[model samples]
Target: MRKLKKCLLVFISSLAIVLISYGVLFYFNFFQEFVTVKDNKVQWNNLPDDTFKSCYAPKLSFSSMPVTEISQTSINLLGNPVNNIKVLEKAQRYYIPLKSICTVLGFSLVKNNSEFILTKDNMNYILSNTDCIINGQSYSLRGNLIFYENKEYISISDIEYIFNLVADFDMNNKVISLLTPLSNSNKSENELTDGKVALIRLEDFSAESVLLSESGQMKFKIIGNYLNSQGIKYHIAWVPRYKSPSNNIDNDLLSNISIENVGFINTLDYLINHGGQVGLHGYSHQAGNNTSISGIELSHKYNSSEEATRSVLENAIDTASALNIPCTFFESPHYKATSKQKEVIKEYFQYLYEPNSILTFHKIQRENNNLFIPTPLGYVDNLDVSSIEKGLAHPTPGELASLFYHPYKELNFINFSKENFGVKVDYSSSSPLQQIVTSINRYNYRTIHVSDLKN
Candidate 1:
């Protein structure tokens, strides 16, 4: 009986050791799953995939009528006349030879088996029949491909959509003008002759009730004071009026930049005296039942007409001028403005503090009499450091590394060390804004104001 009891005790001890060993191994694997050390860099594992999602979808119906070759049309590529390419009209849609357009754009076109591949820089477009694959993503073409004289032809609309170029058709003059937002040649003499340039824009400063609060004022002061101390120039996108859609406030609430609001206007004056320049963001920064700061002020849904857009710009400019605030630039709220609205805005302001289009690079480019200075580095939402780094890495020589930041998010900027899944996450005390400025400096980009850019 004693011998049997000894054996049972030994067996139980061994079982307990095995269970503890298994638990330790499982815990280690779980910890490693979340935190990984790669190439001397610590990164969080199992994060969401950061692949680019295509906003474009295939058109529902494609035109398949008989083709009518238009021989008398004049082709203009980036304001330069092209003499070799002829336009084709099918079902009232204008099409141009793919190879000729590619040649002018400096993109390579190669036929691979049954598919035609078009490539330029990092963009790859594969064309097979009515199907199109851009950058490894499949989409449907709006019109059927035509083969003329052993060359493939695509519609002008497709060219604009795929290549991020603008196409203007003149029916009377038989002219089709193709324009890109950025041009390597014919650069403006007043453009940034310095290596690369960086501009910082502060967004969503308004007279809203929330922004007028003590907390809001403190946040703005912090950002303004920091930038001034660094000797960095920045632009304040100020909304002159605040209208709340939720409260059903139809009347406009003025920003009250006068001496009556001593505290707020004083802060503004201080910022201006330091290194801040004001830009007219929008008159109210909202349309109809939309709230300020969150709604688009000028878009197809509201204030889209040329007359209405002109009225808004005039009102905004007049208001700023009356306040003695020098606003030489205009930025559409949420960067949402129609083509007609942009044209009117260009007439009102010397510079546009936004991109010419969604696909255009963030560079200082001129159109007619106006200059567009886009924020290519984007904004610091939730302090996305990786995205800002990616933007800084992508721009070629002579491009702008501009970005914006919301002063209200200052409180969320804090350093902390927390353990998740048994791995320590040490967040740096440096804010994304500071990191961006540091990166820009490291890249040897000279910071400049939008007013300094010449058209």
Candidate 2:
């Protein structure tokens, strides 16, 4: 009996030691495995020691200001100067009169006690002091609500934020230039006479790769010059950084748009000057060792957290802002992202260039304040025009026919012929892209900027 008791105690001690070791290993994540993609193969490895310690810091922050009085200011609504519109200056921030601005925007503003209700079409905004409800969604105003001289006032930034309009405030001149789709004073009514519109997007333009080469520069100029001559405004899906997946060296894989890439920047500037708008197209367009342009960046497979998503977006936005390029819209790499990731995207951009789904395309879908512009015609793959023509065949009045094409493909299509090897490619009538645009024009579809379709 004594020997059996001693043996039993030893066994209990051994079992406790094993159990405690297992718990400690799990607590330290020794058993946890993480995936590292290499050469298109998935490799599982133990979590790194500093994995938990590293976290992405937020790149954006907002500062609140107190209300203060200052000088009167004038306003410009789509280049037309407005007179007698009293603007309030609060803590160096300009606040436009809600009633007066609403009147200019053709929106009806009604006051009930301390609250003001602004309505236009399907949009509704209820402003009560520092709180605002837009389209049934509530938001706290960064600039405090002020009542000056028997009229309610909202900050210039707030006006842009709430109404989805672009507001540029010139502090020195005390002039606020407001641009909205609502204002059609600058547009000819006959442009979209049939109510058919089309948006052209050039995809995957980055600082690195062939786009910076001499041939690449010519191709870009060809496309830009052609679009300008056709009176067509388009969007460029710009990737701020290019990461080549096949390259193992860190320095070789990553390329940024900086002063070093002067030639590329100049080409971009030329495009922008000729009615080309830049749209954010992911930071690297790849996660880990996956491919760029083809790989998914903001899906559950990679950026699972909102913090990670915001960090990626901020990086892209900051990169473009550094080069003085404006990113008014966002297009996810390969148009792949989770719903949660898209929600975070909405916090930054007012427009998203994508479709409702793979099957549903042809209309602009609105989510809260962000607009999801669809690409109904898809892309021209290997110079195939069948898909594009099929999309152009059917048109509903007021419907949008949007599509994207890679400028690099133009090089292949235009230069593949031996006869045209050394000759300059004229994009006006020779290229398939020009043909697609001509088809869109033939269909009575007026080419318009993405912002013009906000209404």
RMSD of each: 23.8, 18.7
TM, every model = 0.51, 0.54
* lDDT string, candidate 2, 1-455, tens digits: 99999999999999999889867754443222222223323232311121121122334222332344544556776566766766555433466677767877789988888788999999999998877899898866645577777777886646655765444334346455665522211223233334355678999987666764555654575566567666677899988776765875222212321222434654675566456888889888888887677767887888879889987898876566444466678888877878888877777776788864533355566555566777867788878877787778765433457789987877754431112112234333557787887787777666666655432
Report the lDDT of model 2 for residue 100.
69
lDDT of 1 by residue, 1-455 (tens): 99999999999999999889877854543233212223323233222222322222222112334566776777787767767776776533567888888888888999999899999998999988777898887755544578877878986646655675544434446566665521111112232233445678888877655454443443454455456555566899988777786896543323322211322443454456446899989888988877888888899888999888877787776555443356758899988897778877876676789888643444455565566778867787776767877767676433456888886665455222212211122223387766776676565555567766531
Cα lDDT for residue 16, candidate 2: 99
- Please state the error at residue 392 of candidate 1 in Å: 2.7
Which pairs clash in the backbone of model 2? none
Q: Lowest-lDDT window of 10 residues in candidate 1?
A: 416-425
Each model's lDDT: 0.63, 0.64
TM-score, prediction 1? 0.51
Residue 150 CA error for candidate 2 (Å)?
50
